[model samples]
Target: MLMKSSKLLKLKFKHQLLMLFMALLTGTTMVSAQELTINGTVVDESGVPLAGANIVEKNTTHGAQTDFDGNFSLKTSSNAVLVVSYFVSFPKNQTTFKTKK
Candidate 1:
């Protein structure tokens, strides 16, 4: 009976350690999936800031418009494709940027 009890205790300890490791791994994965903020300025060909420019994540509703100084910030996944455009009268462009981990 004594030997059996010791074996059971060792088994329980190992199980607890395994559970803790799995929990930590899961937490890290969730943190990595958290949203990221991207910031930048929109400029025209003449090197002038383009205010009110439309910035959006391709194929998604996540978007933002440039402020008075052509600066804009939006939250999205770490890997996202952005579509930047001016008014309908102007041209449109697409850009892809990777966020740092």
Candidate 2:
């Protein structure tokens, strides 16, 4: 009976450690999936900032517009694709950018 009790205690300790490890792994994964902030500037062919350019995350409604200095910032997941659009006197121009992992 004493030997069996010791073995059961060891097994319970091992199970608790396994559960703790799994919980830590799950928390790390959730943290990685959290949103990340992205910042960039839109520029025209003349190396000038393009103010009021629209920046949108691909496949999602999250977006932001460039300010007067042609700078914009938005939050998205890792390795996201962004669609950028701007128009002046001519037709609207569009481009795509991919965020780094």
Candidate 3:
């Protein structure tokens, strides 16, 4: 009688282990947030695309600047907290990023 119970316990344990394995393989038990991408263009007060406008992600080391066409691309985990600065333009502090759709 005791032997039969022990076998049942081991079978239950094996089934639990199998369930865990399947969950890991299928990512059913785990989920992650979607990443964000920031695509923007920098312009001056005159509405002209400002080339070389410095765009830096605040608190983090990642950064990028505008090209000659004033276009820039940045990637982050979510809504990017950025610092946009340029010699010709006012220093933009704590700028909220616009996520691309």
Candidate 4:
């Protein structure tokens, strides 16, 4: 009777751990699904595409470099402020946009 009780206790503990792990996994997926992708093009004052421009999310490490056509895409949270930088010797530009569900 005592051996049976011990075995049952172990099984219950394992089941509880598995349930906890599954709950955490589901929560992570929900959070990641809320992330948004932003796309835009970088241009110079003369309206010419500026390839290799640096696009970074303000206050975060998320960033991307413009393609040959000055296009860039990055994933970030909603209402993020993006810093668009070009010309190593010049100042950076800031732009803000929000994400939709």
Candidate with top TM-score is 4
Which residue runs does candidate 1 get wrong by more than 4 Å? 1-34
Q: Per-residue alpha-carbon lDDT of model 3 for 1-101, expressed as tens digits?
A: 99999999999999999999998867842333444567889887788998888888888877888999999997765666888887854767568765467
The C-alpha TM-scores of every prediction are: 0.66, 0.58, 0.58, 0.83
Question: Candidate 1 has what TM-score?
Answer: 0.66
RMSD to truth, every model: 4.8, 5.3, 4.6, 1.8
Order the candidate numbers by lDDT, best to worst: 1, 4, 2, 3
Q: In terms of lDDT, which candidate is strongest?
A: 1
- Candidate 1 lowest-lDDT run of ten: 92-101
User: Which pairs, if any, clash in model 2?
Assistant: none
lDDT of each: 0.92, 0.83, 0.79, 0.91
Candidate 1: tens digits of C-alpha lDDT, residues 8-94? 999999999999999999999998777788999999989899999999999999999999999999998777889999989887898
Q: What 10-residue stretch in candidate 4 is worst by lDDT?
A: 92-101
Instruction: Write one digit per residue (lDDT tens) for candidate 4, span 1-101.
Output: 99999999999999999999999999999999878998888988888999999999999999999999999999987878999898777589998887654
